[model samples]
Structures are given as structure tokens and as C-alpha cells.
Target: MEDHTAGHNKEKRYECDVCGKAWQQPYLLKIHRRVHTGERPYVCSICDKSFMRTQELKKHRRLHSGEKPYGCSTCGKRFARLSGLWVHRPVHSSERPYTCSDCGKGFKLSTDLKVHRRLHTGERPYTCSDCGKGFTRSTSLLEHRHTHTGERPYTCSQCGEGYIRAKSLRAHQRTHTGERPFICAKCGKSYTRSTSLREHQCTHTGECPYTCAQCGKGFTRSTRLLSHQRVHTGDRPVPSTVCGGGLAMASHVLSHQRVHTSGQPYDCPYCGEAFDSSRELRQHRRAHAGEQMLPLQQTFQEHAGAAGAPADTHQRVTL
Candidate 1:
């Protein structure tokens, strides 16, 4: 009798010397070696996220550029990739041809049913190296690794603010653009992000899920609870990038770092005035539009003094 398992192993065309892993293709073997070599040649120009393959990098670039080349003929709604358009096609029709044996859930796409089966089988193919958190999707695992590495690839070109997720960068960019896309159905007020709209919606519902143990104070958002606890514990976790140990919120930290970096990247299109951050630029615009505004951050004034004067002097002398 012939040993079939050994024969299958012998059939593998390419093998890695370091790990002794065999692959059917030479290109696959070359890509597998990158895991050991720590070589990521394909870099995203929009952010700094690196990829092992050229195709993976190309797919990622569409997220930043918002390019949906694949369009559906039935509805004309577009997607970044062909696979997305294929997945979307089932939604228009009543036909759900693929059925999951485990839970009897019918899906239009075979891929969707395959993913749903993983939930029943408890098979998570994607995993994190740091904490070993398993996710079904590779994209979710890629986003999860950023928390462990502190690798914020997506950055705001407006204020040099770094963000771990592209979606966060998009939301932050809206602030610079003065875009209020997320509108409240109840109050008719608009917000830059959906999270802000959700938090505001909770106010109307009177949903106080987050409760403080110290004073029994209830809050809508966990961040509001953390801020309230700061008054009691005096634990300001967010550290300042400008001066050491001058802890504040993440928003305030970026606003403060402008003085250190001398970054007045936000340029007014109306009057060509430059400001340190988007908030500052917004206030400056309001002045130009003849609107009443409040005082600017005190840190902006403190910069006019010695600690900040050098950066201003340098920019003035250079520009």
C-alpha cells in the first residue's frame, strides 16, 4: 500500500528552510518568508501601513481614496471591490441559495454562510500575536493589532494628528471641513461623527448606563464617567506631547502639541490665515464671517511667551 500523506507532502513544489513549511507555489513561499524576514516592501503613501503583497496594498488604498470602481447594474450602488458587489447582489433578490447546516440560516452568498458557520464551529482563523485575541476577519485582526503596537498609520494632514483607524481619521477630517454629516432625528442637531450623535441621542432617551461607584452619578458615555472620576481620583491618563506629564484629554493633547511642533497646517481659504488646529481655524473663520466667538485656548497665549516664542520666531523668520 502507498503512503498517501507522505506522497502529498512530497508534492509541495516550494519549501522554506527556516520553518520547513511547504507551499504549492513559489510566490506563496516567497511571501511566507516575509513573516520571518520582517520585510514589508509595499507601503501606503496616504498613511504608513505596510503590506507583504502588492494586491493587499492596492485594496487598502481604495479605503483612503474612497474609490468604488465596482458598480451594480441593478441599483447602481458602487463598491471598492468586485467581491463587495457580488455580496451586495443577493440583497436585491429573494433568492437565498446557500443554507448553513448548523443553524439552517440561508444566505445569498456562499462566503457569508461560510463565515456564519465559524460562529457555530468556534473557528477563528485570524489571531493577534500580542494578546491572542481571535477574530474571524483578517481586517478586524489588523485593526486590533494597532492597539498593541500603538501604530497609528492614519494621520490627519490638516493638524498632524495620528489615528489608529481610517474611519477615525475620516471623522476628524470632517471637523476641518466643517462637515456635520451625522444628524440627530430628535433634535435636528448635526455632529461630525455617528458616535457623537449616538451619545446625544442617549440624552433624549435618558439612558444612564454608566454609573460612578464613588458618588453614584450616572452618565450616558463611559468617557463622561472617566472625566467625572478624574475630579475624585485626579488620575489624568492622557499625557501631553508638548510638556511632560501635563496630562489632558486626547483632543487637548493634539491642540497643545501644535505649539511644540509649530504646526499651523490649517490654512483659511477665505483670508489665507493659518492656525495651529482645526478648532482654532474654525474660530478664526467665524471672526472673518462676523460671528460672535468665545476666547481661544489659553495655551495659545502661553505660546506667545518664552516656551512658545521660539517656535513662532522660527516660523516667522523662515516663512
Candidate 2:
């Protein structure tokens, strides 16, 4: 009987009837059967989180220990789990495997694709308990937590600026380091972030794909058009640049440029001195003395006289 048992010891095979899954080990087969039975024996003492498999519970306990074994080769970022490091691998490769069904937008991971799909469905599950601000993912909520807690763990070594997220800190450090990794293919202009470079590329392409239904005004990006259409409804402030003498748009700057070149064509003929701009002429007509222009250069004289030396001390010393 001992010789027969020793021969048959390695020949054991077990299969689950419910799932029709086969396992070589009886212990593995018993574990597999729990999936069908929905029985979770392993439970976390701290959080009351239950796991059907003991292996999953063992992996989850690493979060409590704060053990991040898997590290990214490109950024040297450590992740709590192997799956997190697996998801982060494409960032270094710049790979977008997941594509959006609604807008055909691509993402590096399926989790990002899931967030993009929420825009089509308008689903924002993660919400702020205090202000009721909704977000698609919990990571956004974690970042938003900094707004309340003021807890910025990530700090830049160069500028000494703190950020809630490591990505934001990395981007901020580029400002001090003068590092622009994302380069434009057409203009050769570089940006610290890829999103900024992508938005800049639209200017070279002349692709104003986002159009307004009311004014028919086109915008290269959705955010730009959203801010622009708000002008009609007075929902937001009129955006302006200081370089254009306080003009709202580039087209407005072009018109202002023509006014400057034409020596203020709509100016008052009473004034003998012609103005370069219409706004300048309008302010001149008001007789309100314009604000004092700030001096561009700081004037400094030689400090040889103040150093207990005469103005002609060099000639006296030579004689």
C-alpha cells in the first residue's frame, strides 16, 4: 500500500464543477472554488476590507507597510504595486494604447481612457464632501485635497516651490532648470510639458476645430472657445493682454497695430500733435494727465568722489 501511494502521490488532479476550472493542487482548487461560492475568508483588521484570495490580501497589506518595491527606470518613481509601475511604463515610452470612442482621443492607460469616456457620459463619481466638487477619478480628489489641507509633499530642489503632486513638482523644477523636454516638430519651440506643446502646435496648423454656434467664432482648443463664448453671455471677464495696449484678442491687437501705424486716424483734429494710438488720443482729449511713465533704466554715477577721492585724484597721483 505504501509503494502504491508513493507512485500515485504526484498524479493528483482536481477540477471545479461550478466554474469548470481545473487545478493540479487540491489547495488551489479549494481557493478557486471560493470564487464561485463568493466566500472571502481573509479580511483586513484596520479597514475591514475582505479578499477572496490570501495572495490578494498579502499584496494589499503592502499599502499599510508603505513598501514600494517597483520603481520606474525613467523617472525613478516608486509605486506601491507592480501593476501601478506597469501602468506608468508607457509615460516613458509615450505610448497611447487606449483610444476614446466618442472623440477618438488616445491615452497611455485604460484608466485614463475610462476618465475620458466619462466626458461623453458626463459621469463624475468622485465628489468633494465639503464643497460638492465632482471629479472623474479619486486621484483628482487627492490632488484637490491639497487645496484644503495645504499639504504639499513634493518640493522642487531648485526653486523651493512645493506641489501636491510629483508631476507638478517635476514641471515646476523645469522652470528653474530651464529644461523644455517637449519640442514642437514644426516651429522647434520647446515646452516643459507635452500638453502645452500640443496646444502650441494648433497655432502652426491653423486648426480652429472648435466653433461657436452663436458668433461662429472658431478656436483651436475647446477651453479657449469655452472662455470666448462666455463673452457673449457676460459669464466671465473679457480676457486681455498687456502687450496689445489692453486688447482682448490677437485680431484686436492687429486692429490696434493699424491704428498705431495710421497715426490714430480716428483722433481729434484740434490737437496739432498726432497720437500713435486711438486710446491715447481719447485719454488726451479727457485732459487727464496720463500716469507717470516708469523709468526703464536705473541711473548711477561714478562713486570715486564718494570714496574720499577728488575728481582729479588720478592726475595728482600720477604727478
Candidate 3:
């Protein structure tokens, strides 16, 4: 009779019924069957988290042990599993295989495509238990929970300002470093944020995707759409502390606060009077230059869906 437990050089006898992938052992083929059956047989003793395969459970246990054995040959970056190293390969190759059907954007991984699809669908699956606010990803919801808990894990090295997310801290650092990486293709204006650059591009294309349902007025920013809707609804939720005047967007509240700060650097060349933002300065300068105010630069959101930030709040603009 043949030696039943010879060695690793055994013949590939077991074949998967779904994909036709062959393995050396019967138990290995049974574990592979979980790909089709959605079976998680291996359970972690520490967290009780189930995994489809024993190897997967072993890799996941590294989360508790803080062990990352797989190291990238190129960058020396560590990962818990070999599959992570496989996914990291595309980062060096500049290869993006996954494409979004809605926007025709490319991503390196299918998981990224899944997240990007939510932007088009407006589907926020991850929700905050505290406020019932929805987020596209769990990471966003995790960062948002910091507003309630008063947690600032990411801190700036220069000015020591704390942020809940690393991305926010990176963006805030740009204010000090003057790192405007995102450049407008049309106007040559650079912005620290890609969203700001895209918003600037809309001026060249005149593409206002956001439109008011009541008045049919087109706006480039979603914040402006929220502000415009208040006119129809007659809602004034955000109130100014200096005056009893209602504010629509957080930008209005900031601009109103400037009336009290008295340290405005943006002074009019024509009148020597100061204003808070460039938009206000330009509007004031237009009067002296005998030029009509364009009413441009509409997007003004102070805090987007934050605890203290004005969300769905209307400001009563007194004419």
C-alpha cells in the first residue's frame, strides 16, 4: 500500500467544485469550499471573531499580538498577512484594476471601489449610535464620535492643535507648511484640499450639480444648496451670539464674528477698511473699483455635520 502521510510533495488530489482549484489535502479543499458557502469555521478564543480558514484566524490573531511578519521587499513596510503584501504590490506598479461605473474613476482595490460607490448612491451604511448620524465608512463614524467624546488623538507638531483624524491634522498642517499640492488645471490656483480645487474647477466648467428644488437656482456646493433651501422652508436654526440675527451657514457665523475680532488683515486697497475673508475683501473692494460684485465663491461651510457645526441650519439674510 502507498504511504498515506508521505510529505508535502503529495499529489494534488482534491479539486474545488466551484473554481476548479486543486489542493494537496482533503481538509484544505474543505476549507477552500467556504469561499462559495460563506462558512466561518475557525473562531478566535480572545475576541470570538470567526474566520473562514485556519490561516485567516491565525493572521487575525496578530491584531491582538501586534505581530506583522510579512514585510515588503521594496519599502520594508510590514503587514499581518501575505495577502496584504499582495495588495501592496499594485502601489509600486501604479496599476489600478478596479473602476467605478458611475464616475469612471479608477482604484487599486475593489474595497476602495465599494467605498467610492457610496458617493454616487448617497448610501451611508455606518451609523453613529450616539447621534444617529450616518457615515459612508466606519473610519468616518469613528472620527465623528470624537466630537462627543472630546478626543483629539492626532496633534499638530507645529502649533499643537489637536484633530480627531490624521487626515484633518495633515490638512491643518498645510496652513503652516503652505503645502498646496492640489492645483487647479484652469486657473493655476493651488489648494491644500482636493475638494477645494474641484470646487474651483466648477467656475471654469460652470457645472453646478447642486440645484435648489424650490427656486431652480444652481450652486456648485452642497452647503449653498442647504442655505438656499432655508429660504423656502423659513428656517433659522443657527443664531449669532453678538446679535440675535440668524445665520445660514457656519461661514456667516464666522464672518459675523469678524465684526467683533478687530484683527482683519484683508484691508481694502481703495478704502483701508478691513474684512475677514478674501470674498468679503473683494466685495468691499468692488464698490471702490466701480465694479459690480460677482456674487461668486458660494461654498461656505464652517463645520460639516459636526456637533457644534451648523447642520441643516438656515440664516435669515436681512435685505
Candidate 4:
């Protein structure tokens, strides 16, 4: 009765020194301290797994026993915990009580609405300790930590290829199954992933959402825009291992390396002609297709004109 009175009166007498968490009961405070001390008093006899609380141990035991005590009244779905039933209850109903003020988005759960609000607020509460990278969600931050640890928990059974995320593994498995689930409504083209389908849809819309600040050049993808910006910035992030020469792109490094070894790796199937790089090979293939190939200077002049820049604006005679 005293415990009930204390809880009803909103009185928390027991407080932890470490985290300053108040509890109505002394025993509850003792259990809370175990979280800071890393002490697990309750042990599962079957699995030998330890838990901070006895209730957690009881929940863990249900996994081995295959016991689900909680049941939904709507769909008759069984759950091991009461919290799971509470979370599942909303799925049966079309009602969304929790609404976001900013985006006018509705969510069934308040916790989900709170996370969605962070997107509008630009609030990244979760941060990485390794590289100091910030993430909007805790799950995203947890996935980012796997990069530093080099852990790929989700693996493909057929090909033995590992991925950091389960979604990536599922997407890669489609390659083996030949499943293209995501289809474009415009062209009726299919893709393994939804992101690829969205990118392809941009071609039909002719929406160049990503634009370069320097040249005013537009691109369908953000990666293409970033690559175009590097041309203006002269940001040679990739360096040649052979000659230590700075190259604008990582793909260009292979061609630059061939200059030192005099290796013509790319070969034309039509004329049996070998080239140092894939770019030259592609140009060689255009000739075989009877396509009029423009000279290097003329091509550069046309590109400069499209970019609203003079032909001699970036000309440099390398000695």
C-alpha cells in the first residue's frame, strides 16, 4: 500500500548517483544501477545468457520455450512481450493519432512521429564516436559503426557475399534470382532496387535536379554533379601509384597508370586494335560503327561552348 501510495503521489525517493535516475522503490534503483555497472544478476539456465533484470531473463526464456503470452484482440497475433502487442495494435486500425506539425505527416506511434520530426528539425542526436559522423537515427548510426569494425553480419548463402545491411543482401540476392521487382511506370523498365527505378524515372521527366555551381551544368544524379564539379575545382583526389600524377577521377587512374607501363590492355573486337585506355577503345569502336568521330580539339571546343566558357579558358600546354 505504501509502494502504491508513493507511485500514485509521484514520489521518487530512491535516486542513482551515476545517471541521476529516480525510482519510487529502493529495489528498482538497485536494478537501474546494474546498467551503469555492467552487472547481470539474472542468468538464463538454458542458454547461460545474462540479463540485468529478472523480467528480461523471463522474456529471453520465452525464445527457447516458444511461448507467446501476449495476444492481439484485433488480428489474434501473438507476441512474447506486451510492448510488441501494443506496437502491433495500430496496424489493425487506420487511425493515426500522432501527426507531424511541419510536414503534415501522420504516424501511428508517438515514437515514430518523434523520429520523423527530427528530419524537419535537422536534429542528428546520434553521432559516431569513431569518425565524428552524425546520423538522424540511432539505427543509421549503428549501421555506420559496422564500417569501422569491418563487420558484415548479413551474408548471401548462395554466393557467400557479405553486406553490412540486410537490405543490401536482399538486393544482391535478386541478381541470383533474376528478380526486377521495381518497375518504372513510364518506360515499363524494371530494376532490382527502388532507388535505381527512381533514377531511371528522371530521364522521362528530364529533371536535372543536381546542378553545378561553376558551369551551371545539370545532372540527373548527385554523383554525376560531384564529378562535374571536380572538373572546375581541379580536385584530383585520386593519385597514380606509378607516376605519382594527380588524376581527377578514380576511373582515370587506370588509364594514367598504363602510360608508365606502355600496356595497351583495352582491345577492339572489330579491328583487333589495342588501346591503352577504355575511352580510346570506345572511340575506336565508334569508327567501326561508321559514326563520325570529332577531333580532340573540336570536341573540347563544343564542350566549352555548352558550358558557357571560352575554348581557351582551361587550355594548358603540358611540357
Best by TM-score: 3
Cα error of candidate 3 at position 217, Å: 6.3
Error of 3 at 312 (Å): 25
Per-residue lDDT for 160-238 in model 1, tens only? 9798779989998998999998898998999998878887887899767787776666666555666555544544454
Give lDDT tens digits, candidate 2, residues 178-213: 999999998899999876887788788866678777
lDDT of 4 by residue, 247-303 (tens): 544434434444435545453322234465667766664643223322222222233
Identify the runs in model 3 with alpha carbons over 4 angstroms from their true place: 1-108, 119-122, 214-319
Winner by lDDT between candidate 4 and candidate 3: 4
* lDDT by candidate, in order shown: 0.68, 0.61, 0.67, 0.68
User: How do the residues 77-140 of candidate 3 rate in per-residue lDDT, one tens digit apiece?
Assistant: 8999888899887777777889999878799989989988887898999998986877888997
> What are the per-model C-alpha RMSD values against the true structure?
12.5, 18.0, 10.1, 10.8
TM-scores, all candidates, are 0.42, 0.47, 0.48, 0.47
Residue-pair clashes per candidate: 0, 0, 2, 0
lDDT score at residue 38, model 1, on the 0-100 scale: 95
Lowest lDDT 10-mer window, candidate 3? 296-305
Give candidate 4's error at residue 304 in angstroms. 28
Q: What global local distance difference test value does model 2 have?
A: 0.61
Model 2 TM-score (2 dp): 0.47
Report the CA-based lDDT of candidate 1 relative to the real structure. 0.68
Error at 118, model 4, angstroms: 1.9
